[model samples]
Target: AVLKATGAKGVAEPAAVLAAGGGRLLVKKMKWKNVTVAIAEISNPLSVSPNEPAL
Candidate 1:
């Protein structure tokens, strides 16, 4: 929800994001309760962390 509000894309599957070359976007690893969430920021003008996997 937070990611959506920020105009970012929320990918439920990390593999999918990596496969789509979304590693350049701002990606965040969050944890809520027992679930792990991956949030990608597509609105950012700069690229995300280079260390991130490209799938």
Candidate 2:
């Protein structure tokens, strides 16, 4: 749905974690007006490949 609307592959919050490496979400997406926020805890930075996409 977000991808269809914005052309982004994924949402910002979870994607941030995946971008860093990969992790578990500590706080799910929270929204207010046009603002959105989320928190994630990276589990193992070395496990995720740098060449991989965040999806």
lDDT of 1 by residue, 32-52 (tens): 786756655443325657788
Stretches of model 1 off by over 4 angstroms after superposition:
1-16, 41-55
Q: Give the Cα-based TM-score of candidate 1 against the true structure.
A: 0.31
The RMSD (Cα, Å) of candidate 1 is: 10.0
What is candidate 2's lDDT per residue for 1-55, written digit by digit as tens? 6789988865968665675456788787887888777778767856768999644
Residue 9 C-alpha lDDT in model 2: 61
Native-to-model Cα distance after best TM-score fit, residue 30 in candidate 2, in Å: 0.2
Residue 54, model 1: lDDT of 40
Output the number of the lDDT-best candidate.
Answer: 2
TM-score of each: 0.31, 0.49
What's the C-alpha lDDT at position 48 in model 2? 64
